[model samples]
Target: MSIPAALRRRTPRGTPATGRGLRLPVSACVVAAVLLAVVLVPLLVPLDEQAVDMTNKLHAPSLAHPFGTDDVGRDVLLRCVYGLRVSLLVGVVAALTATVIGTAVGAAAGAVGGRTDRMVMRAVDVFSSVPHLLLGIFIVAMFRPGVWPVVISVGLTHWLSTARIVRAELLSLRSRDFVDAAVSGGASRWRVGVRHLLPGVLPQAGLAAVLMVPHAIWHESALSFLGLGLPTHRASLGNMIQDARGTLLAGDWWPTLFPGLFLIVPTLAIASLAGVWRERINPRRRSELML
Candidate 1:
């Protein structure tokens, strides 16, 4: 017995096909490893008792002080790791918060169209009109300058983009035959929205969340750099850069350079992962790649 020509497997002409289905990108792996180290390494390796060592201050990079010392004599390497942790924490929390809010608003607008959609979209437009950085600064300043304030400010300001993305996704999903069938089968709007519509929107929501992380991180850093985010005492990538501003003129570059690299690497890695994810999720892109 032999297989028919029409049923035979067809290899893509100009591309090599692998047996592996979907593999994580190398950039994602590196980003995950870096995040894991940032979160866990500090817990495992005991920090120096005098992380703020005044006597060892301003020492250049050495085996003892790999990232050199800050103006206040704090170990730059230890502080960098801790700062990375803080930044990552803020970014993840803010992104999650935004995603939740966006999903809720988008779902509501999509499930109930006409006047409700118009109202919600108008509100989104209003929020989008304001410069996010200014809005974040104002929000942070209105309350006391602290972690929660920065988290809330960034989270609130960044939701508009996600909301629009999710709304579009849900609107498209709402018109699908399955959704229509579900509605006709005695499923209430709420039930259909939750059971059918929401599930379909999750993938887009997830991609939006991942893409939001880097933006949130940078937003928090900017706020901190401008002295409106985390307090000066707190170790954050933004504050580290802020602390280095004066030192740059004194011919010392390690303080700013190292922290900047620390910030940039993970951000770029996550963004690359997001691009890969976007391609994976887009039907047209997926189909083109498959060929």
Candidate 2:
């Protein structure tokens, strides 16, 4: 019999399994560093909003201001740290909101199948047909530009995929022998769903939530860039980039470049970690990739 690809060692059968070792650790380290920056930077380094030196404004990278100064002579490095904090907050909260909404809807639809399932799925399809970014823009447009509005926008627009994942997982769990046994033992639908089905799908749902963080961060950044997210006074990756357009055009690059790096690095690190989790959770999908 042919061994499954996912179970096979990366090298030959006799060799050490080395391919998976580096990625997970490196990604974890990067993510930890980002979280540390988000937590410690604000408390350790204070930024005085009113203290701007026009003579020192827009200085290129130097020993005094490592990441350089912005258009108003504020430290770019400090602002980038603040931006990461805001972006991380928005991403994590929005993802959790989406996960909760999706899990509830999906659990209901899967647990009470038949007409209810059909109706719920139809609703999902209708929502999914619209692009997430466009829908997010519309939702955010209804509220004042701020952190909460952006969070709500990203959460509402991003839950469709999670719902589908959860619904499918619950449906699969519903057909299992344990579920049928519970039903035969006079257990109520709600009891069986809560005790059995919910636990089975939690891992999948958790993975989906983890994967949503990067997308949520990017969404928040995009909205802020468009001036529909956090206000201009707030330190956000999108707001930073938006505020730096003139300087970038004027041939000074650090203002735009450093914030963009901060944004890109975390998203990539989170994505890598998510990939590792996906492979560990779903060996079949990983096997397919090895083919």
Residue 78 alpha-carbon offset, candidate 2, angstroms: 0.6
Give lDDT per model, in order. 0.85, 0.89
Model 1, 1-291: lDDT tens per residue?
999988655533323445222334567677888878897877897876236777877889999988899888988888888888888888999999999999889878876789999999999998899999999998999998788898999899988888888889988988889987997899987898779988778989999999999898898889999999988888888999998999989989988998898899888788878876886788776776666
Off by over 4 Å in 2: 1-19, 49-51, 283-291
In candidate 1, position 59 carries an lDDT of 87
Clashing pairs in 1: none
Clashes of 2: 0
